[model samples]
Target chain A: MSELLLQKKHSSYYYVKSKLSTGLPLFAAIFLVLLIALLLLHFIWHGAPGITWAFLTEAPRNNNTEGGIFPAIYGTVFLVFIMSLLGVPIGTATAIYLSEYARQQSFFSRSVRFGVNTLAGVPSIVFGLFGVGFFVQFIGKGIDTAAQTTIWSKPSLIWAAATLSVLTLPVVIVAVEEALRNVPQDLREASLALGATKWQTIWRVVLPNSLTGILTGTILAIGRGAGEVAPVIFVGAVYSLPQLPDSLADQFMHMGYHIYVLATQSPNAADALPLQYASTLVLLILAFSLNLTAAYIRLRIRRSHK
Target chain B: MSSNSTLYKKSKFRPFEAIIEWIIRLTASFSIIIIFLIFIFIFKEAGGLIFGTAKELKPKKAVSEKVQDKSEEKVKPEIYNPETGEIVKIVEVKKLVKAKETESQSIWANLFSDTWQPVGKKPKYGIQPLLIGTFKVTLVSLLFATPLSILAAIYCAFFAKAWIRDIIKPTVEVLAGFPSVVLGFFCLVTVVQGVYSTTQFLQPLCTNIADIISWILPFSDRWIHSALTISDFHYSAVVGGIGLGLAVIPIIFTISEDALSAVPNSYREASLALGATESETAFKVMLPAALPGVVAAILLGIGRAFGETMIALMATGNAALFSWNIFHPVRTLAATIGSETGEVQWGSLHYNILFFLGILLFLVSFIINALTELFVKKYLSKKFQGA
Candidate 1:
C-alpha cells in the first residue's frame, strides 16, 4: 500500500510538471498570435471609418491634413509598374541561367549566388545611400553635364524606381528560380528527345509551365517594392506634391512616404491620426493581398506538381 | 529525311541562338555588377575623408577668405590711425590661424570621442554614442525576442497538433509581412504609450525592490538608485527595442522552427523509446541537435535589428545620447544615416561620415552572413549527414 501510494504521488508530480512545461510554450505562442491579431484589428477599427471613395479620389486641401491619398496611390502604382518593367526580365533571365544553364559547381555561378545573398542582406538604407551616390550624383550628374541641362541631377521617379528595382532584385530571382526548378526533368528530356535545342526546349516546355510562377514573382517583387520607404527616401520620395508626376524626372509623393510623413512630421499628430490609420490600412491591404495571391498561386503550383 | 538533314545542317550554324545565349549569360552577371557599383560609389564619396583630402577644400577657402576680408577692413583702419594700428596684430591673427590649423584633429580622434554635435561651429563627430545606442537596442531586442521565439518554435515544432501548427505558422508569416515603417509607426503611436503606462504602474514596486536590495547590498546603493528610477516614460531605447523585437520575432521563429523540424525523426523515436516524454524528448534531443541553426537564426536576427532604420528612427526619439538606462532616448547608426543624409550637403563631412557608418554596417552584416554560411551551415550539413 505504501509503495503504490509513492508511485501514484510521483506520477502526479510528473504529470503536473509536464503540463506546466507544455502550458508555458503554448501560452507564449498564443500571446504572440493574439498581439498580432490585436494590432491588425486596431488598425482596421480606427481606419475603416475614414476610408471613403472621396478619401481615395480627392487631394488634400489644407496642407495634407484634409486631403485624399489619391496622388500617393498613383505614385505607388507608377513606381511599382516601372520597377517591374525593369526588374522582372533581368531577374527571370538570371534565374534561367542559374537553374538551366550553370553547371553544379562552376565558379561563375557560385559568385553570382554569393552576390545575390549579399544583396539580400544589405540594408534598405544602404541601398538609399548607394542610390544617391550612384544614380543622383554620379550617373544623373554625368547625364546633366552631357546634355547641358539640370534634368537628371536630382531625386526623381526614374531614379527611385531604379533603386527599388535593385533592392527587389533578390526577391524576384529567388522566386523565379524556385519556380523554374519545379519544372520536371522529364519534360526537358522529352523536349530534347524530340530534336529541340536546349533553348527551344526551355522556351516551349519550362517557360510555359512556370509562367504563373513568374507572375507570382513579379507580384511579390511589386508588393515588396511598394511598401519600401527607406530606399526611396533619398532617391525620389517627397513629403508632398501638388500634382502627379508628369515625367520620369518629376518628384512624386509615395504612400509609404506619406505614412512616414503623417506619423512623424504632421503639424498636429492627434488630428492626423484618422488619416494615418486609414493610409496604413490601405497599404496593409495592398501588401497583404498581393502576398496572399502570390502565396495562393505558389500553393496551387506545388499541389499540381504533387 | 532529306529536308530534316538540311534543317539540321542549317541549325548547326544558328547565330541567333548563340547571341541569345550570350545575352542570357550577360544578364546573369548584373547582380555582381550592381554589388560592385554599390561598394565603389559609397566609398568614392567617403574617399576624400578616408585619404585626408576632404580637408583640402572648403575650410581652406573659408579661412583664406576670412583673412582677406579682415585685411581689407584693417587697411582702412590703419590708414585712418597709422600710429594706433600695429602690424603685430595681423601677425597675431596669422599665428592664431596657424594654431587652428594644428588643432584640426584626425578622423580617428573625432570618431572615438563621445560627442556627436556634427552641425555646430566646432563640429564633433564622435560615433561612440551611436555605437553604444545601437548595441543597447540590439541587446534589448535580442533579449526580448530570442527566448520567446525559441519557446514558440518549441511549441510549434514539438507540442502543437498539425492544425494548430498550420494556423500558427501562417500567423507568423502574416506578421512578417508588416513593413518596418508600419511597425515603427505602430511603435511610436501605441507601444510608446503602452510602455509609459506600464512603467508608471511598476515604478513604486520597482523602487521598493531597489530599496530593499540597496539596503542589503550597501555598496550598490548608488547604482540601484539611478537604475530604478522611471520618473517619466517617453520615446526610448526600450520602446525601439520592443518594436524591433516585433520585427525580429518572426525571423527567429521561422528559422528556429525550420531548424527544429530538420532534426531527423529517428532521434525522436529513439528518445521516446528511452522512456522520455514528448517535452523531454524535444527539449533534450531535438534542441541540442538543432543548436547550430538556432545560433545562426539569432546572429541573423541581431544583424537585422542592428541595421533596421525606420523603427530605430521613429521610435528611439533620434537622440544620440550615451546612456545605459533603457528609458533614455537613443539613436542608432542606421537611423543617423536615414534622418541626416537628406539634409546634408553632398560630399560634406557629415555625408562622408554617414557613408562611413554605412560601410561599417555593410562589413558587420557581411561578416555575420559569411560566418553563418561558411561555418554554421557547413556544420549543420555535416551533422545531418552523419546522422
Candidate 2:
C-alpha cells in the first residue's frame, strides 16, 4: 500500500474527494439510526404510561377507550398460530419440491416459482378481497346452505388466518427453499450411495439440517401475519368481540385492527390516543421481536455452518 | 431383528414412500392452485359488473309472468328436475344486476372525471383521481427512497468499514420486517403530526409557487390552498408518501447493496490502482457497473410502494380526490380496497370496481416485478458472463 501510494502520489483534489466520500456512509448510517430512534421515541412517549399489566391482560371497557387489550393480543397470537400451522407445511413441501425434486429449468418449477412470485406481489388488500370472495361468500356460504344454517357464512378467524397463510406463503417458501438449497449435495449423494432412498435421505438428513431455516421461515411468517391488517379486515377482525374466540368460526379482536379502529372509527379519537399508541407499541414489539428472533436464529445457524 | 430386516427387504419398493412423495407434490402445487383460484374468483365476481344481469325477475313477478306466459309460445323455458322428474320452482336470481347507466356516456368519459362518488343518484366511477393519488404517493415515496437507499447501499457496499457494514446491513434489513401497518400507525399518530408541525413552522419561509401563479391568473388563493391542504396540520400525501418511503427504503437498500457488493473486486482494485480515490472509484466505477441492478432495485421498490395498502389506508386520509399538490390527502387503489371493501354491497358495481382496482393493482405489480426480475437477471448474467 505504501509502495502504491509512493508510486501514485495522488493530488489534493482526489484526497479531498475521498475524505468527502466517507461522509456518505456516515450520513446514511446516522439517518437510519435517527429513524429508528424517532420511532422508539414516539412509542415510549405515548405508550409507556398506558402499558400496565392490567392494560396487557384485561378486556377493554367504554367502547375500547379504557381497559387492556388482552383479547387483541390473544387473537393476534392465535391468528398467527393458525396461519403458521397451515402455511408452513405447504410452504416447506413446495420448497422441497423446488429445491430437491423439480428440475429448475422445467416449466412446472418455473410456474411454481412464478406463482410464488406473483402471490408475493399481490397486494394484501387483494388477498382480503379474495378471502371475502372465496372463503366467506363462496365457501362459507356454501357450507351454510348445505348445513341449512348461517353459522359458517360470516367472516371468522379461520378465514382471516387462511387468507394470511396465503399472503405469507412466499415468505416461507423462499426461506425454506434457500435452506434446502444450502444443504450440501455431497451429503445427499453420500446418503443415496449408502442405499437410503431419496425420501429417506431427505427426511433423515436435509430436513433435519434445514430445521433452523424452517423455523426462521415460520417465525418470519408469524411476524408478518401478526402485523398485517388488510387481509384480516373484512375476513374476520372486528374492533370489539364479545369474548376471545373459542373456535375458528368466531370473529376476534387484533392489535393491528384495534389500532386502526381506534385511530379511524373511535367516536373520540383523542380519548383513545394513549391506548392506540400503546397497542401500536405492543404490535411493534411483537413483530420486531419475531423478526429479531428469526434473524438471530439465522445468524446462529450461519455461524454454526461456518 | 431378523424378521424386521426381512420386512425391510420386502418393502424395497415402498408404497409409503410413493404416497408421501405424491402428498408432498400435491402440497407443493397448492400455491399454483390458490393463485389460479384467486384469479378466477376475482374475475368472476367482477364479471357481474362487466356483463350486467338480464333484468330483475322477482319471485312474485316471475310467478305472475310464468302464469301469463304459460299460454304463450315464448313461454319461460322449463325442464323436469333430474331427481324428482317433475317441473321444479324456477328461482329468480336477478336483483342488484343493473347495467351501469354509463351507456349514455362513453366509458372513457366516465372514467376520466374528477369525482369518485360510487353510491349516489348518479354513480360516477372516475378512476382518474385514484390513479393520480396512487401515482402521487408512489412518486413521492420513490423520489425520497431511491436516492437515500441507493446512496446508503453504495456506502455500505463500497465505503463502510467492516464493523459498520456488519452492524448496518442487518439492522436495515430488520427494518423490512416492520409491518406496513405498524409504520402506518406510527405515521398516522406521530410522523404525520410531526410533518404537519414542521410544515407550519416553515410555512412563512416556504412561499408557495402557487402564490405567484394565482397572482398572474385571477384564481382564488383558496384554490391553491385546497390543492395544498385538506386542512392545515392533517393527514396528507406527504406523510403517507414518507411512510411509504420508509417502507420502500429497506427493499431498495437490500437489493442495491447486494448488487453493489456483487461487483467484482477486480474493478475496485483496478480503479484504486489507477490513482482514483475510493469515493471516486465507488461513484464512478462501482455504481455504473451496478446500475442495472440498482435500477431493478428501484423498480421493485416502486412495486412495493404501489401495492402497499395498510400504510396508505391509515395515513392518506382516505379521500378520493384529484390534486397535484402533495399536501392534500390522496387515496390510493390499495387503500380504497382496504377501506371500502367491507362496506360495499356484494356483487354491486362498487364491489366489482374495487376488484377491478385489484386487477389493475395486480397487473401493474406483475409487470413491475417481471421487469425487475429481467433487469436483475441481466445484471447477474453480465456479472458472471462478463457481457
Could you report the DockQ of all the candidates, in the order they appear? 0.48, 0.41
**Per-structure clash totals for the candidates:** 1, 0
Name the DockQ score for candidate 2. 0.41
Q: What is the C-alpha lDDT of each candidate?
A: 0.87, 0.81
Model 1, span A189-229: residue lDDT tens: 78877988867877899899999889999999998999989
After superposition, candidate 1 runs with Cα above 4 Å error: A1-17, B1-15, B55-92, B217-219
- In candidate 1 the C-alpha lDDT for residue A234 amounts to 83
Chain A TM-score, each candidate: 0.94, 0.90
lDDT of 2 by residue, A57-135 (tens): 9999998889999999999999999999989998999988888777656787778888898788787888898998899
Best by lDDT: 1
lDDT string, candidate 1, B1-387, tens digits: 011111222348677777877888899999999989989988887776676557643386568658857876865455444666556556656676665565453566887799888898877889999999999899999999998888999999999999999999999988888988899999998999999999999999999999999999999999898899974759988999999999899989999899999999999999999877888898889999999999888988998899999899899988889787888889999999999998888877778888989888888887777776765658898999967
Model 1 chain B: lowest-lDDT 10 consecutive positions: B1-10
User: B72-94, model 2: which lDDT tens digit per residue?
Assistant: 43323554467887654433222
The positional error of residue A97 in candidate 1, measured at the CA in angstroms, is 1.2
User: Taking chain A of candidate 2, what TM-score results?
Assistant: 0.90
User: Could you tell me the lDDT of residue B385 within candidate 2?
Assistant: 74
Q: Candidate 2 - CAPRI tier?
A: acceptable
| Superposed model 2: Cα runs more than 4 Å off | A1-22, B1-19, B54-109, B206-233
